[model samples]
Target: MSLALKNEQYANELWRYKNTAGPQRQYFRMGLAAVLWRFLALHEGCVAAHCAVPGFGVVTTVPSTSGRDDHPLRTMVADMVGATRDRHRDLLTPAPNATSLGRTASPSRYTSSALWGENVLLIDDTWTTGHHAQSATAALKASGAGSVAVVVLGRHLNTTYGDTATHVEQARLRRFSWDACALRPWSHG
Candidate 1:
């Protein structure tokens, strides 16, 4: 997932900014769809929903690129729902954002029969500003869902280039560890 999110070179300007806006995060969600399904135990009782914005210009919609096949996010989602065969339906909500990465359209355009008879798990790539999730949840409710929850791969930390509001004030942090390479020039103890 980090591989997809990483750029070889990050600018000082880009570094200081936290992108609460959400496009990148959605991309991350797409990348992590497999793990999400397994984690949620999403087999038969619920449906998975994908948010469709008209012009966001995402190159790949599938989340996984394993075994030489890149399954689109939609495909992975369908698979997750399928794993729970007869358990739930899968719905794709298409709301054309006014522009790529624009705020989600009004919920008035959405209807719920797609997921009405069952619970739903709203799936997206990221959750920074959370506008998309909020709008989608409201739409799902209007559509008659019994319940709705969200699953995402990463949370936006508001760590923009200059401001560290999310990381500092919100206390969102990550820790990493590494083991020495087995090929190292040291004798075994």
Candidate 2:
């Protein structure tokens, strides 16, 4: 479940500015974190409403492959004072000597320590190609994590990039609503 779609001035700018170095960087990151805080506060009852699992036992964010010991996104989640604070754990990291992890979904992109079936709630600031997020999921599963649910802060859309413009046009034709559905990652497990 994503909080919202991000493009240009929407949630994009906040996400972008949060990464670059500066004095105002913390403010931008806080704004992005606020979105997550609000979502959990607003949908307090629906996260695990109809899902098989009781609730998420652990929360994690995609590790930045850029070699930061603690990615800013991970830091944002870590600094959260909300209920998510305790559940957050630094669970995944880029695989040792991984290659070709760019737009493609490859399990080799990340690695994690063995888990004891902790249900994981994987969060990411944005979803571009989803290669990083999906790869993190694969690594968690391989390491024995259970029922990983992905939640993106934003689904990035570049109107001028490839077929996205057409998809954006098609999406705009529909009316948005609050109706939500739960996607259980371990439906078949």
Q: Model 1: how far is 171 from its true place, Å? A: 5.5
Q: Could you give candidate 2's per-residue lDDT for residues 26-113 as a string of tens digits?
A: 7677777786776655443355554457888888898877766667778777776375788888888787655555678888899987
TM-score of each: 0.47, 0.79
lDDT of each: 0.40, 0.72
Model 2 error, position 79 (Å): 1.3
- Return the top candidate by TM-score: 2
Query: Cα miss at 147, model 2 (Å)?
Result: 0.5
Candidate 1 least-lDDT 10 residues: 56-65
